[model samples]
Target: MKNRTIDYILRATWQAVSRMYNEEAIKYDASMAIAFALLSIDREGISSTLLGPNMGMEATSLTRTLKKMETKGLILKEKNPNDGRGVIIKLTPLGLEKRELSKAKVKRFNEMIRANVSDEKIRHFIEVTDVINELINNKTIFEK
Candidate 1:
């Protein structure tokens, strides 16, 4: 039987989700990237180096986002005591409030999906995703 490529399906699904988030974020005068960044940070702080990897973001893009967030008083950067060369991203009071709103939006989206999708299907989806990740990480994707 003919079928669509797995990569195409993945990309399409993600694009749809991103568009949906961007639309929702507009209502709060926020963007998906901003909400995602806020979600990635810890209450105390998160290391700049660690943040990029956690969010799968490029250094330049992340830097720009952080700068905007700081400008908006959503976050602050302080010297990391443990690493003088690095900084910690700390959410401000306003940042905390926004983060909570982001959290609720994320929960709402996930709950909507979970309510519609069966548990068994979700489990299979997770299993497939994990296997795909493992294959790529292990460089086994093209193995004969």
Candidate 2:
């Protein structure tokens, strides 16, 4: 009660950041999910399988987002030449424009943070997150 927990701080900070992004996204008629997906897609196109993992999204969520993006004329899904059963996701011209907007917003946010926070603190924050990710990926946090 006297001290805040690590998870509490992480969750609260992320929620605030997420809210900020959502507010910015709304100005472009987008959601954070859509913006993130736009940024994740490659110019040459990416396999659906790879896209989902790269975006840290589940199949169902990614599928829904992709469908919405397709409806909005932001992306196109085409057969992957390398795999008969796979599809490649490519950004449309509009998608590319949206992607740039998303990129700019992210850059501005980071720039603001860097202007306020020392570089060393940012590096330490990244290191801590990397360690957290490694622990999660290695399944060491809950091992028997």
Candidate 3:
């Protein structure tokens, strides 16, 4: 029963995230968009190889997404000065702007959800989410 409930919750969460992004703005591959959002917030540039594992993406998928982002002028890939073998990924100004817009939209969506949901339920949901995140992090359960 507990396992079933957890599985249902996980599926629901994924569906909600996918729907939220798909409905909001330009239609993009959700995973790639998520990667872009992470890069926008990452002060230090990230490596493509590191990103692929972190995002649970295959190397080829990451490469394709990076190429599209580069063509769109959303990101710049440069040789890492410290590690010549690595490529550093950084968001361009346009990418930063898009990220900001997406962040705002996400915030608004959250606000709407909060307004509709009871405070007690919202607090419980937050607590459950935090616990799940902690469990995944502590156990290193997520695919890399």
In terms of lDDT, the poorest run of 10 residues in model 1 is 1-10
Clashes of 2: 0
Report the CA-based lDDT of candidate 2 relative to the real structure.
0.94
User: TM-score of the candidate numbered 3?
Assistant: 0.70
Alpha-carbon error at 16 in model 1, in Å? 0.3
Which parts of model 2 are misplaced by more than 4 Å? none
Q: Any residue pairs clashing in model 2, and if so which? A: none
TM-score of the candidate numbered 1?
Answer: 0.94
Q: Tell me the lDDT of model 1 at 69.
A: 90
Candidate 3: segments with Cα more than 4 A from true spot = 1-4, 27-44, 53-56, 133-144
Model 1, 1-144: lDDT tens digits are 123888888888999999999999889778899999999998988999999999999999999999889988999999999999999999999999999999999999999999999999999999999999999999998988
C-alpha lDDT (0 to 100) for residue 20 of candidate 3: 60
Instruction: List candidate 1 stretches off by more than 4 Å.
Output: 1-3
The estimated TM-scores of all candidates read: 0.94, 0.94, 0.70
